[model samples]
Target: MAQVDRQQWDVVVVGAGGAGLRAAIEARERGARTAVVCKSLFGKAHTVMAEGGIAASMGNVNGHDNWQVHFRDTMRGGKFLGQWRMAELHAREAPDRVWELETWGALFDRTPDGRISQRNFGGHEYPRLAHVGDRTGLELIRTLQQKATALQQEDFAAYGDHEARLKVFQECTVTRVLKDGGRVAGAFCYERESGRFFVLEAPAVVLATGGIGKSFKTTSNSWEYTGDGHALALLAGAPLLNMEFVQFHPTGMVWPPSVKGILVTESVRGDGGVLRNSDGRRFMFDYVPDVFKDKYAQTEDEADRWYEDPDGNRRPPELLPRDEVARAINAEVKAGRGSPHGGVFLDVSTRMSPERVKRRLPSMYHQFKELADVDITAEPMEVGPTCHYVMGGVAVDSETAAAEGVPGLFAAGEVAGGMHGSNRLGGNSLSDLLVFGRRAGLHAAALAAAPGPRPRVSPEQVDAAAAEALAPFHAREGAENPYTLHQELQSAMNDLVGIIRREDEMAEALRRLASLRERAARAGVEGHRQFNPGWHLALDLRNMLLVSECVARAALERTESRGGHTREDCPAMERAWRPVNLLCRPVEPPPADPAADRIRLERVRTEPIRPDLLALFEKEELVKYLAEEELPE
Candidate 1:
């Protein structure tokens, strides 16, 4: 076997998505030589697909919106499972981050008062999302990409100064993290184009490798979101938290089978789109909780009235939380009120002007025009739930984004757990990437400032990883297609462990995942290593298996339905449930005990809510009561 060469670096960041790019930039600014490794092209990371705006309490559209409100909304939205400190930091810092993006040439929509526009979203009490029309993620990625490009230019101009350098290795897939005496040293990577292995030795390593949504068959997440960071951290002995709580976006395009699961941005609803059944009846009014009952209009007359007088009446039917909307759509489809593709309708034409719709939702219009041959301005779009984001990930501290129990290993963005908790509100993820990404970079750079000698990379470890990576190519057995297995995994997840779950279905999902894991061991590839889709899928399959097991096992352990882990068997949320977090650690394969082979689950400690925070919930209830009493007809 040919051995690959190795190199040393001050800091190595994996997964060049929004979080990785942001962290790399910050690390460079902090005077550390930083290298970014990604499996795909830099600009093509999954962050580009996020269409909804970034949530920030900018107080642009509504004076009532503020950081406190944003914080409270985030906590409630996550069902209080989120770390209060992280939520607090995210809420407070998000406004400045969004504004910082503006300074870097991001052109967001303007409010009537000429400030960055804020719009209403599910779980937010007031309009607080800072947006660039509808393709906010695109604008964000473009701006950040440009900024990183500029930084690279500046770094080159600095004449080989390590402090200002940022080295990006595109299409380089990290196979395993290298550890030194219980600390993360660096990682072993394989360059896709050259099919050559390399070692990056550093004092600090950051994993910003997004979510595990590819585990599910029908999802809004991109092909690259294979839960790499989650698996890597688990393999490196870091605990993963809340792995069961997966957020399914309420509206995804449900026609043209190829694009069936593409996310139909939440901004559609925020901009006055209404979800309806075949009979043209709005269904969300009947499903909302008492907290939002007074705030939501039931009748079409009331909805139209609320639309016309935004602040004078209740909120329109479209702005319900994702969970509520998903459940409503499920009921609608089950009751035989669905469209041809087994989805309900999202109609925006009734509420917004065609010109306004086109301007605010260019992507939505373009997607429909290019893919479905349907125009959003003329007809209702078929929509349903699609697995989008993971609320669970490698357990980490709110401040440092450093993985708990794992020294020298840090995580940020979708990979690091505990920010969103049980459910994430729309637009919060972008803010999460920026806030935690920067924190991880700063923290890692500070740790690197001591300049410990580079740890040695084990040739044996690299060889083992390389063998596993290349095993697919050498398989001579009957063709075992990775894509087919991936589809099966996704289907199983979507059907059994989806928006709603029951104990039996979750158990079945676990069984299916175990079978998939066994099959993945024999999975085959029929192509060379360079840009081989088969090889990529095979690598991603391992991640999907680990993540799926984590999610399924966590779901079965939690007896109550709360937020995204809705269990039909335990239909109601138990007060005793109280934000119980499941921590996952990978168990090495041995003389397999059938029972023990299952995901080993353990509950983690959660600090009691402060009296002041508990008081706020009480105050919110009182406000809800008063609003109910003063309800408008």
Candidate 2:
């Protein structure tokens, strides 16, 4: 066996997205030697692909908008399954974070008054997203990257060496979180370009790796989102919460096969785009669920009028939350109301003027024109649902972002669950990456600073991890292609357990996932490890299959339709299911109990909502789901 490079640090952060970068910065600020490791270039993490904006109660657009309203909207958008404390903190702290970004050189679009301008997004009570035209995410990542880089330069000068207080290890993939006893001691990582192993030994580790979107066929998430953090945490004995709640964002490009699942930003709808069926009828009015009744206009006249006078008229149904719109699109296509591309029409051409559409959403204009050869300023574009985000992740404390049952291990960003609950609203995701990312960094740094002996990784564990990583190359004859298995898994997830699921279909998905997992273990690849895409997929297949099982099992267990999870047989939102959060954990493989294998999923009733927060809602609303004993004054 080759010798693995070993390096020690106070903290190791897996992932280099908005969350991981923020965490690394905070960790370094707290005097911990930190490293941010990622599978791509520093600025190319999925954060840059976010086209909407970050949510914050800056009150630049509407004076009535405040943290409380933002908090309520976030809870409602998530269908109230999110952790109350995290939501509260995110709503309250987000404005400050956004403002701080401006100081760090985030040049956001401004109102006439020179205050940070905000934009409209689905489920937000007021226009609450702080943006930079259509490229808010790019500006955000740029600012953070510049700030972190400046700090890194300062550290390099101070140390008079290449090593800095905060370092970024780009194009590195972490395969395992090394554990010492019950606590995380470090992680096992490999450079993507070289495929050479490196053991990063740190007292504290933060898993900020994003989501599990690649489990499905049509996803907007990058290839890096193969459930690295989810699987790493689970293998380290941490539980994942609400694994079934996956968000399929509406309005992905559907015309061109090459760009089928590519995201078409919600900014189009926020900027006055409309959804129409093949007959040129506005169809969103017919699909509004009862839970969202009275919030959206039901008639074309009212919907059009609402766009001009949102204060007086109900908002248009086109501005409904992503989950609602995605399901509506699915239903329309099923009912033969789809366009030539098997999707509904998103028409901004009829609403916004050509100049306005081009100016406000240059990316969307270019994306459509270049990808599908459609001019959004002149015609409607074909759009449908795409697997966007997973609402479930490593279960963590709302305050600390500490992984359950795993000491010295924490998570944030999309990897940490219980923030968005059943479905995340637009703009909330960016705020989540900041609010919780900072918390995880601060807490992980503190954990590293605590008075104790530094955690250490055992040589035996290192050898085992290395052997496991190398097993795909040493497989005997008759091995299968990792890509083939990945395609099969994606087909299973897309066909059976997608946006609309059924009892029998989900059960079949579980059986298929089990078979895939078994087969993935025998995934083999040719050639050496260096820059080998096949070898990488062979490893990622394990994580995807494991996370897919978690999703399939939890979807089967949760009998009610809520938020992103819709069961055709169980369509109504059952109030009784509101307080329960299904928790997923993997037992030892091939257990004596068949049910005790990779995914031992079970429900854990969530802690009752805090009394003070519960008091914010109306009495009528509280009684709908909460018991008298659970409600507070």
Candidate 3:
């Protein structure tokens, strides 16, 4: 391996998604020279594809809604397993962040009174989502991109304000995080377009690389969400918490192979969509328990009445939390009420006017028209669950977004754990990116400002990372195809550990993952580094393997169902199970480079809940909120 060109930055953020961009902006504002690195174009990051609105306590739709209620709802939603501090911070700061975005030129939809509009979503006590129809993510990305560009121009005019200008490294893939002694020093990356290696030296590094949804065969996540940050943190000995709690969005398009698993935004439900099977029966009514039974109208007449009167007696069908709705859909399919396409119908045309649908869901309308050739305003959308967000990630303090036990490294957004706990509420993820991403940035920038002696990146460490990166290219005798292995991994995860899980199947999934890991060692690559899908897949496979293993292991350790990690074998929530979190750390290789042992698992202590909040967990208030909320549609 040749010596790569080296550049020093005060802060290096690996990812240009919502979290990364926010972090870069905050760091620049805090007087740190920041660089944003990503594997794709800046605006093309997966954040652009987010369809739902952002969650914030703007109190625009309801005066009763406030941060305290939001905080309480979030805690309950996560089954009391979420870090209370992070949840508190998210609720407190989210409203301000949303307003900040508006100041930055984001044009959110307005309510009847002209305040930022709020909509109902799963697990919220009141309507709190601020949105722009359904294409909230696209609007957000475009606004941030424009802001970044403007900041760049302003910095150029000032010339000496190096901190104001952010250096963006596009098409750069980080292979490994380089540590000096015990702390993170820098990172090793390869430029995809030029096929040249670059060593980025920074005192502070932020990993915002997003979720591990691609580990499943069917997912709503984009190709870039391969869990790179999760793998990188794990390899660097950071503890990953709650790996078992993966969220499955209930309404992914199931028909038409070309558009398979595309997300059907929850806002459709929030706007009055009814989920029905071929039998035309509302199944959630039967599945809902006493907890949610009263909150929603029991009959179709009541549902319609609720729609007619916004503050009426019935809860809309669209307001059901994702888990409850997903389970309901699964039950319908199992009961042989599925449509010909193996999905249930999400019908909104009956409640919403065609013009209203088009105005509110332009992107959704366009997507269905171009991809599935269906007019959503006239027809029912066929939908089912698809792997979406991971609610669990690296354990971090809520205030700082700093990974516990790791110094000089920070995490934010989906990569950092403890905000959502067992499940994430709709519209909360974008807000999380803004609030926590900025916190991580401010903290990292502060550290970077007080300059100490620069840490050294050893030649040996660079060689090892380069060898691992180039192994697939040099393996001429290997028969294992990286793409096939990835497919197999995805299939196994989808079958065994997805939606509802069982012990026997989860064990089998683990066995399959171990086999895939062996094959990944000999995975082959045929094309050059530039624009090579095969090579990119090969590299991404490693991250997928680490994430899959962690998730499988964490699922196995938890013997009770809570939040997203549902186990058919253990059908009930166990209060005793709340004490410990399943923490995973990479096993150190033995001296003389012996084969690495299985990753070690340790049980970390979850902060004890206050006595006052115990009833929320014991009584399962969050679960009730999910089961009963009146969705808008």
Candidate 4:
């Protein structure tokens, strides 16, 4: 048996991204003995890779913009499938979160009048994103990290030791959420450097572990985004809501095979870029959906005027919600109007000067220059769809951010569902991490401080968890290779259950997933546990496969084409399907076989919207796109 190092804390936060760091700062400041565990080194999380901006209705640029309008746009962008309370709370609190970040020393771009400047993004009615050039996400993470570090220093001043109390376990991967008598007791994790096991016992566990984009072949998400928190919460007995909704961003780089699928920030379009075909004609006008047909401009001249005078001219079709734009790009590529690199052309030069393009989108300019050998300020770039984020995850309370079925377990950020509904707005993620992450931390600290005995883990449970971690190294000979299984899984998800979907293909995907699950169990690894990539992937596969099962199962069940989930058979959004959400649950095996465990899914109907929210929208706005569900007597 592997030696296990045991420790105790008031709260344990999983993941070290913007959400985790923000949660940790809140928990530690509230006097909880907090610890953060992550799969990568501190400050290297995917949060730092975000480049567009943070969404908030601060009303800095446009006086008419406020939380109500932000709330309405969010619900519309989500296809009205969003949880009313979460969306409401997010819009209401996001502005404060941004201002708080500024107070903590985040340097955002300022307007000519010296207020924090806001920029335009798709699905937003006005300029609503607070940015720092094209590196807004970087500033968010850097500022959050600084604040957390400052809190650790305060802990040191008061307690004389921060390392033993408020700590960060970097380069560590948590495999399971340990429970004691039906409540979250702690987490079981292993360090990547030494392959040593550790047991972190905390009364409360907050899962801030980002999204599931890494499950697909072409993704902007990094390796650590393999749905750890989503899988952990599910296995620990929490239902994942709306597992079918996965967003494919419209403009990932398509040329240079090595850099394919890397994110081309939405700031390009937000800063007046346009999409065109090889025939030198703008194509977004031909792809506007009925829900937004009257709102978007149909001609290039109108679109150009809308950038400067949005109230007078309609919004541009190029600025449609991500799902609509991604589908249009895919259709154009399939219709043989694509560039030589199997994509359409995204150009900013025709509208903005070279100096302004470089000044506004410095990272994007450098990214294209260094990776593709293309100068974006002077020319267009080849772009296509790439899997970006999952809008489904562990279902949590709208107010408390507590996992619905699991006690003492909280979730926030992309790991928790309902905030974004079916499709998320581009800049909403950073703001979400701040808004809900604080709530989860605040609630978790109070729960840990409540009158209850400290949870304990038995030796038998520790031994079992340790044994499971080591099984991949001792499997029978001729077992499958972890790398091969991973590639096959990614390929299946991309080809069968990608941006566009068909009933027959998704059903076949489930069969392949079942087979893949079986093969994954028998997959083995060689070499010592020290820094072995194969061993790491072997364990991560268990999580990736289960998450894939949830996604495929939900995709097969949802018939309507709405937001991120599109079904060719159904073709259009169905009113009947609008009021329900698909939830994924686990079916533990009767014989205690991990390999035989199956993921079961069912649709749970959503509650009717609040009367106040219904009043915010005009009747014409929801005539076909979304209508309030009828209340039962």
Q: Write down the TM-score of every candidate.
A: 0.94, 0.97, 0.94, 0.98
Q: What is the clash tally of candidate 2?
A: 0
Clash totals, every prediction: 2, 0, 8, 0
What's model 1's overall lDDT? Answer: 0.83
For every candidate in turn, the CA RMSD to the true structure comes to 4.0, 1.7, 4.1, 1.6
The residue-by-residue lDDT of candidate 4 on 125-221, one tens digit each, is 8889999999998999899888888877776787786355579999999999999888999999999988989999998999999988877999989
* Model 1 C-alpha lDDT per residue in residues 1-633, reported as the tens digit of each score: 447777777789998877998898888889888899988898889998888889999888778778888888888788777888899899999988898899999998887768888878877878878887778888888888898899888877877555447888998888788887788888988888877888888889999999888887788888778898898898888889999899888898898775699888888887789988898888877787876777777777887886676554477757777777787898889889998888999999988899999998998898788887988998998999888899999899888999998788999999988998788999899999999999999999988887567666667777788888888888667757898889999899889899889889988988888788777777898767766777888888877788888999899899987778888889876655664678987775532542235357888657655555555564665343222322222
Clashing residue pairs in candidate 2 are none
lDDT by residue (1-633, candidate 2, tens digit) is 448889989999998889998898889899999988989888998988888899999888888889898888888888888898899999999999998899999999888989998988998878899999888888888988998999888987788675767888999899999999988899999988888899999989999999999989989989899999999999889999999999999988887886788888898998899999999989899988776677788788888787888564378888888899999899999999999878999999888899999898998888778877888899888899999999999999999999999999999999999999899999999999999999999999999999989888889888889998999999878897899999999999999999999999999998888778777777899999888999999999888988998999999999988889999989977777888899998775536532234888777777888777776777766666554556665
User: Candidate 3 or 4, higher TM-score?
Assistant: 4
- Give per-residue lDDT, candidate 3, residue 446: 89
**Candidate 2 worst ten-residue window by lDDT:** 588-597
- Candidate 3's C-alpha runs over 4 A off are 160-164, 312-314, 590-597, 610-633
What's the candidate order when arranged by decreasing lDDT? 4, 2, 3, 1
Q: What is the lDDT of residue 53 in candidate 1?
A: 86
Per-residue lDDT of model 3, residues 240-273, tens digit only: 9889999998899998787899998988887788
Positional deviation of residue 194's Cα in model 2 after best superposition, in angstroms = 1.2
